[model samples]
Target: MSGLDETLLDDTEATVRVRFVVNGRKVACEVAPRETLVDCLRNELELTGTHAGCEMGACGACLVQLDGRAVHSCLMYAVQADGARIDTIEGLTESGVIADLQAEFHRRNALQCGFCTPGMLVNAHELLSQVAEPNREEIRDALSGNYCRCTGYEAIVDAIDAVAKARCEGGGAT
Candidate 1:
């Protein structure tokens, strides 16, 4: 067989097995070489909290923590995350890692349509973990990638700022 034929054969091969520790649970699934991590998480693993918006890296709707860092799930192939630790909104919620953020979002009415909430919360969690006390401008800068079509970002920024203050004061809420 020619080299091109070999390449074609490889492309037509069966699904590849990918493994990850998701939400403190071990998960393994077979995915096509082209299957994105968002598809794997939502379709294969049945974790739908991670939304797929724009299907590109520009939108942060498919954000998930990969190996302790937020990443665009829609841009990463499942095979690329093999044997990695993945955390979707479901995982973070279950772990109570973002409870304060969730509460602040609710109190501030930061979320509107709920489509971008998961990604926003995930990114906020990541930002807070990195910078305990980020100003409003810094918060906005961090959320520049995530797009929310519902409410103006004022409430979101307010919520994050409130959370930051609460956390610093050890109150956990504003």
Candidate 2:
């Protein structure tokens, strides 16, 4: 191993305490300096809905709402989010903020294995939050970062579009 690698390895066992508001609850935990947020959320916080796929952030399976914006948890260290507000799929589901979207996705059968569903839902929630009504192309573009191996993405896009239309018709109630 290189000299710097060896030096850094000595601190692998070290832990840092971090506090954050997760899913409308205050939480604090000790984690290693290099521990990714995905690992902390899944292991320490037990928020398994945030998958750890593609730790390098290429896959959006680890997507979560950090400070009200969609972020790849796999790309962020737990310590970096010490004071942020994080919302996982579990939180969103419990709050029923995305109920319509979830219903549409289920009705359209937009998922198969369900591994990528959480991230897709988080991304979709974020998209709809910013753009009340997004076209199919816009929905597809927003979902470009999230990869779904089970479905062809056609159903997912259709679901999002339907939700957008429904929301608009419902007097912009999201």
Candidate 3:
């Protein structure tokens, strides 16, 4: 083998210790160099709400809020989350924001099979946090990343619009 090939084979694999705030709790975990954030959330922390669909960052099933921004967990390395604040779907109910969304989803029949609800809720929550009264276009744009095969998006849009209207009218969604 060439010297360069030999050196490449000898390269060491490092285990990184990452510390981050997840789901309102501080957590520390040792992860491999290539371990994705979704793996840590589901495998290590057992937070299964963050699903893995495409594993290519396309389905948005692994969506989570990283530092208050909606990010695809499958697209991020666990080590990259070190010292960052991460919020999964599980964290949403603690504040009732997600619960409200979930309730609205149910009322509007926005979910079926239940696989995409978590990601959808996380994305919707992030949108509502920034724009409490987003219009139909804005809601559609915000949820464009998430894919739900069960609902044709009409119900989902209705659910989001209902939430926005409730929030704007000085009323709680749930």
Candidate 4:
């Protein structure tokens, strides 16, 4: 095929093989070019911790760490994430990086239905990394994108704030 034909051929391929590190383990998948990362994780890998909501980047329920940064999995294509490091909620739990935050979230009643907990934890994980001692306002701002229908945002804010305070004081699991 000529150069233009090859380009079109690559674009029209039904599925692309993507290889990446998920949660710390390397995984490879053959996914449709149009499949979103969340779909790949949920459908192909059976990693269901990343919820599907809004699917347009508005709701943060599908948040995951892409290359150490929080991103909406629903908004990212699986092929686009090839060769990248992806960390789902399960990975964070296995690593124990979010143990303290999870404990605080439970203690402070941060989640009720638990649908948004994973995304909330993912975003909270990012915030705690950037700011060791975030105030209530800062915590609220960090979690603004995640929506919780059960909790009124107060408990979630308290949980994140408590964890931030404990970490800043050097008593946290950091």
Better of 1 and 3 by lDDT: 1
Give the per-residue Cα lDDT of candidate 1 at 136: 90
- The digit string of per-residue lDDT tens for model 3 on 1-174 reads 445545534534657689999978999998886889999999989999899999998888899999999999999899889999999988876777677778899987999898999899988988898997999999999888899998899999999999889888888665
Instruction: List candidate 1 segments past 4 Å from native.
Output: 1-8, 11-13
Native-vs-model 4 lDDT? 0.92
Alpha-carbon RMSD, candidate 4: 2.4
Q: Give residue 74's lDDT in candidate 4 (0 to 100).
A: 96
Candidate 2 segments exceeding 4 Å error: 1-12, 171-174
Off by over 4 Å in 3: 1-12
Candidate closer to the true structure by lDDT (higher is better), 2 or 4:
4
Each model's number of backbone clashes? 0, 0, 0, 0
Clashes of 4: 0
How far residue 172's Cα lies from its native spot in candidate 2, in Å, is 10
| lDDT for residue 11 in candidate 4, whole number 0-100 | 64
Per-residue CA lDDT of candidate 1, range 87-120, in tens? 9999999999999999999999999899999999
- lDDT for predicted candidate 1 compared with the true structure: 0.92
TM-score of each: 0.94, 0.91, 0.90, 0.93
Error of 4 at 67 (Å): 0.4
For residue 50, give model 4's deviation from the true position in Å: 0.4
RMSD of 2: 4.5
